[model samples]
Target: MKIDIDYTPENKAVIHSYMRNVAQGNTAGAAADAAADAAKLYDAGSATVQVNSVVKAESEAGIDLKAGEVKVSTENQTTTNVSTYYKVPNDGKLEQL
Candidate 1:
């Protein structure tokens, strides 16, 4: 049997936030809460603003992984280049990518 899974950008962002909090020694509930908060904030803003915020927060928090850092490999494509990467701090400000 073949199983399919749907992972949306929002879902991935939530998971990423949770994992990051957990890695920083936050409890599961705390991590979930933080992720939820981040998601809500992101959803309230425009796409450009949202992306900028995430990146800034990650950078200020010393997070190694920023949004759009990972590249998806295709069967036929050997490589991919991310056009831009944003670094937003947790201070709730939007920075350029």
Candidate 2:
């Protein structure tokens, strides 16, 4: 459930690399290089993933059933004849008591 990550000292290395790249300029130059590093969709289908790309979470929302209703079939049988007492249907079929 954790979506965003907190910044740590490790981020400094990445920031430094970006600054160095900007100063030295990328080999491919600005226009020839990718517009931006496309964020990998967490769990999205990898049908279009590059050879070295790894995919995680997808764009679709997960299914939730907390508010859903489930149905079960039940039947009530007559129990007036106490001596000939029977019990509720074990196989879900109504039978006379």
Candidate 3:
């Protein structure tokens, strides 16, 4: 829930103007108006506010993890390669997959 602003020249100019207006003894009402407008322009026509959520489903029927696998679906994407890993054993010997 954090936003990072890349301060380009155009953005810097708008921000400076807004600050100058506030410092010039402007009315609180006008300053608030300017701030709202600046916020609109800053986020204009951008998908930056939309958030994507990941959902992990719980199954009612039990499944065996030892022999079962998971399938991930990404939008219009295909798998190129696959790799598997096994847990490291507490003993010196490495666990097999």
Candidate 4:
């Protein structure tokens, strides 16, 4: 799984600060910061969850992949829109493009 995030410097600073606060055991502060950042990013349309495939096994073990678009679940938050992408490689396995 991979996610690409592109945001303004202020948002990036907020994320960095949130991580630091979490690492420093500031749970209350981190939680508030994370919630705020999540809302801001959601409104700004600056986050993307891009997934290629779901790999189930190693290639040596006859790799099997459930190839399809990924669905993101944001509980308690309504999504205005979502873009789904479908892709399948010729090998029938998940390969990074």
Candidate with best TM-score: 4
Error of model 4, residue 31, in angstroms: 2.0
Give lDDT for model 2: 0.34
Q: Which ten residues in a row have the lowest lDDT in candidate 3?
A: 85-94
Candidate 2 colliding pairs, count: 8
Residue range 30-68, candidate 1, lDDT tens digits: 866886755644543333422111221112223346563
- TM-score-superior candidate, 3 or 4: 4
TM-score of 4: 0.32
Global fold similarity of model 1 (TM-score)? 0.24
Give the candidates in order of TM-score, highest first: 4, 3, 1, 2
In angstroms, how far off is 36's CA in candidate 4?
Answer: 1.2
TM-score of each: 0.24, 0.23, 0.30, 0.32
Local accuracy of candidate 2 as per-residue lDDT tens digits, 25-91: 6777652322232111111111221123333432333454789755544444432323222223112
The runs of at least 3 residues in candidate 2 whose Cα sits more than 4 Å from the true structure, single-residue gaps closed, are: 1-7, 29-97
> Which 10 consecutive positions of candidate 2 have the poorest summed lDDT?
38-47
Candidate 3 lDDT tens digits, 1-97: 1223445664566556666776786786677868775564445212223234444544344444777865544344234323332322122222233
Per-residue C-alpha lDDT of model 4 across residues 26-87, encoded as one tens digit per residue: 66646787777655444433333344334243222233458755544333423333344322
Between candidates 1 and 3, which one is better according to TM-score? 3
